[model samples]
Target: MNKYGRQSGPRYSASTNSAKAPATQQCQKCLEFGHYTYECKAERVYKARPTRTQQLKKPLKRVEVEVPEEFLPKREGLAAKILKDKEAERKKNKDKKKKRSRRRYSTACTHMQAELRYFIAVVVQQWKQQEQQEQQRIFTQLLFRILALSLRLSFSFAFALLLEVVVRIPFSLLLEISVALSLVQKQEQKCEQR
Candidate 1:
């Protein structure tokens, strides 16, 4: 590793034995030892240049552009009138919104009163309807009770009449036995006459 650009053999060299010898660093590629990657010649060998045909054949595209007013004639009176009318309309709309909010504030008491009246009306209507319905339910229950009592009384009366008819039937049977014995004695006297 001297300034003559030649490397020494792998064995320890007598030239490097002297401590005054300059230290040598190694290159990874081509196995040369002069420089590192920042000064690599092999990297500069592959740098590409664009061809003339690639530069000449490129296409052009349209771009949108806005022209200033100074580049054209300006409308003076008509544009001013239009701007004024637009401003007036905006002011009118703003006033209308302010008036609406003011009216809302002014009538807040009346609105509350109306809401209270509506709530009371609804509550009273519901209460009245509930009372009517309850009255109807109670009337229906009373009617059912009266009908049930009449039915029970009629059934009991029918049972009592049936019992009375059963009791009278025994006396009728005794009358029938006495009449049948007299008829049989009359028939025997007629037979003896014959």
Candidate 2:
């Protein structure tokens, strides 16, 4: 059995064309309850219904009338008044332009001042860099001069030590001192090269 086809209950047969029961008001024609005035079996009164007014798609054309010159509105001084207003506006615009020029000059001066500060900063930075390079060069020269002086002193001292060993000490000790001096000189040379 299909559930949607029919339910297991009593069926109802409703008529779409059947008239509905009237309201519980007495009819004006028959003075009866549950009946409308129009459905009464009496002389039917015919009353005219108010009809709706239709609006025109296009409006009616306007009629033009000729107006006399002296009786019409005056426009004699309109151009003069407009010219005066325009002159006043032009004066105001001129004043505004002068103010704008002054403002532009002030802003330009401020921009130039900023650029000048930046230029001075760059110059100072370059000067510092040059000074640092010069200091580094002077230090390197001083270090080289000191290294050469130390090598000369070491050679003269080794010669003096070798002479003292040969004159007052053993030959074996002299040989050891000479060998150590040669090694020291070679190491100093390497350091100088670096």
Candidate 3:
């Protein structure tokens, strides 16, 4: 038979209802009702107990348990300040980039203007050169015409002198001879094969 026998010991019932009776009986050490053996205050309370001779003869054993490091919470004000600083720095860098690009744009504009000025100068110089060439051609043509007229005039004057002063011929006849000579020269130049 069990130590708490069926007939002479505390009765063991199959009831699970807590309102009728507590789950666990009175503690064996404190005689208090409710709760279980592991959760009992009497079990948790430490008391001075006799040390066994086997424990006294052995050296004390040290137990090593690993504990993780605890994380400290960040200060809200400091975190906000750091975020603001980062945003300000980002804005400043963006503005600096804008300024740099603006400067580059201005420099490029100046460079383009200089190129335009140089292009205009080149065009003007070319125009001036063409005008000068045209003027030079016209002047040379005029000079050639003047020289030819002067040569013809000089020949006529020489012929007149030969007839009137040396040969003592009439002026009207000499004039007629000079006119015929000029007409013959013009016809010969016109009819000559290229």
Candidate 4:
């Protein structure tokens, strides 16, 4: 009996008789039309299960086999050719490094030259400013010296004029005293003769 408690037999429907053409039958076990499920030819393939012998079988292990030197492929001059190629690559890398270094050196030189020019220009400007300050200092000192000399000359001339006035006053008083004495003497002699 099947799982549904039905006998394992062919089932027919009313539609099978009404159809003029014969209907194709399919087997549930093998999924093929034309035969019933119990009469399927692929029953052994679908119902067969693995035995303990098959389950216990181990997988195959790989074995290494040595090849003879005579059977190996030949590479006669390949090592020399590889050496030459490596040398060429090394030379190319060295040339590239040299070019890069040359470019860097030229750029650094130009940068240094520009910095030197700028430094010189700044120094020159500072020197000119310092020279101008020195000249101004010298001119100021000369002007002060001339002004001091003129003041000294004016003070000396005023002092000389004051000394001449003081000396003339004393001399004039002495002359007046001498003239009055002479007049008094002449009056005394005339009184005695009388």
Tell me the TM-score of each prediction against the true structure. Answer: 0.20, 0.25, 0.27, 0.28
> Of the candidates shown, which would achieve the greatest TM-score relative to the real structure?
4
lDDT of each candidate versus the true structure: 0.48, 0.53, 0.50, 0.50
Q: Cα miss at 167, model 4 (Å)?
A: 67
Q: Give lDDT tens digits, candidate 4, residues 56-124.
A: 685457698999999988766889899999999999999999899767756764664455344334434
**Two-way TM-score contest, 2 vs 3, winner:** 3
Assess candidate 2 and give its lDDT. 0.53
> For model 1, where is the 10-residue window of minimal lDDT?
146-155
Clash pairs, candidate 4, are none
Stretches off by above 4 angstroms in model 2 are 1-78, 131-194
Candidate 3 stretches with Cα past 4 Å from truth are: 1-76, 131-194
Error of 2 at 110 (Å): 0.8
- Flag clash pairs in model 1: none
TM-score, model 2 to reference: 0.25
RMSD of candidates 1 onward, in order: 37.7, 33.2, 32.9, 41.6
lDDT per residue for candidate 3 within 27-124, as digits (tens), equals 55555677544345564445565579767888579897765546545556878999999999999999999899767756764664455344334434
Model 2, 66-170: lDDT tens digits are 899989977759788999999999999999998997677567646644553443344344444654656444433432333333343344443443343244333
The candidate that wins on lDDT is 2
Candidate 1: tens digits of C-alpha lDDT, residues 35-100: 654334663334365677865677446596989879967666888999999999999999999899
